[model samples]
Target: MTATVQPTLDGTTPPAPVDYETWLAAVWPHFIAAAASGRTFTCYSIADTNQLPDPPNPRAHWGRLMHQLRDDGYTRPAGWTCSDRPTTRHSGVRTWKGTAAAQREAAA
Candidate 1:
C-alpha cells in the first residue's frame, strides 16, 4: 500500500514521494561532486539549510537519501556527528565522504 504524504505547513499538498532510487538519481551527482572534492557534509545541512533546493518534504526526502547513500557504499569518516542543536533531526546525522566509484559515475 502507498503512504499518504501530509500537507506542508502552508496547507498545500506535499510532493509525491519518490522511491529512493529515483530520488538518488536526481541528487547523487551533488553527493558525488562533494565526495570527489573531499568534502564532508551532513544530510541535515543539505536538507534543512537550503544546500539543495528545499524539497517539498525535506525531512522525509533527505532522511531517506542519506540512508540510501550509506547502503550504496558511500563512506562516513570517524569521530563525526551531526549538530547537537535542539531543532536538529537527530544526533545520528552522519558525515559522508565520496568514493572513487561514485566519483566516476558522477563524471560520466
Candidate 2:
C-alpha cells in the first residue's frame, strides 16, 4: 500500500523519503563528522546541515540512528534543548555530544 505523506507542522512539504539502508549509509558520515566536532547537536541539526536524505520512516529512523551512534561509542546524550528543525516548531529535543572515540575516528 502507498503511504500517505503529511505536510510538516510548518506547512512545508517534507523531502521525499529514501530506502532505509541507503539513507543510513549516506548520512552516517555526515553524522560522524558532526559528532567529531565535539559540539552538542540535535539529529535534525546534523541532517539539515548536511542536506541528508530523509529516511523511509523518519520518527523511527532518526531515533534508531542516534541510539546506534551511542551504542557505537561515538556519541552520548548531552542534554535537552529546543529543536531547530523548521518542521518541529522549536519543540524540545534531545542533544548529543561526541565521545573521545568519535574524535579519534575523525583524526584517523
What TM-score does candidate 2 reach? 0.80
- Write down the lDDT that model 1 would get: 0.63
Worst 10 residues of 2 by lDDT: 15-24
Tell me, what's the RMSD of every candidate?
A: 5.4, 5.5
- How far off is model 2, as Cα RMSD? 5.5
Q: What is the lDDT, from 0 to 100, of the residue 12 in candidate 2? A: 92
Q: Give the poorly placed runs of model 2, Cα more than 4 Å off.
A: 1-17
Q: Residue-pair clashes per candidate, as listed? A: 0, 0
Clashing pairs in 2: none
Tell me the tens digit of each residue's lDDT in model 2 across 1-108. 998889999999887756888888899998898899999999998888778777888879999999999999999999999998888899999999999889998888
Off by over 4 Å in 1: 1-25, 48-50, 55-57, 82-86, 89-92, 103-108
TM-score of each: 0.51, 0.80
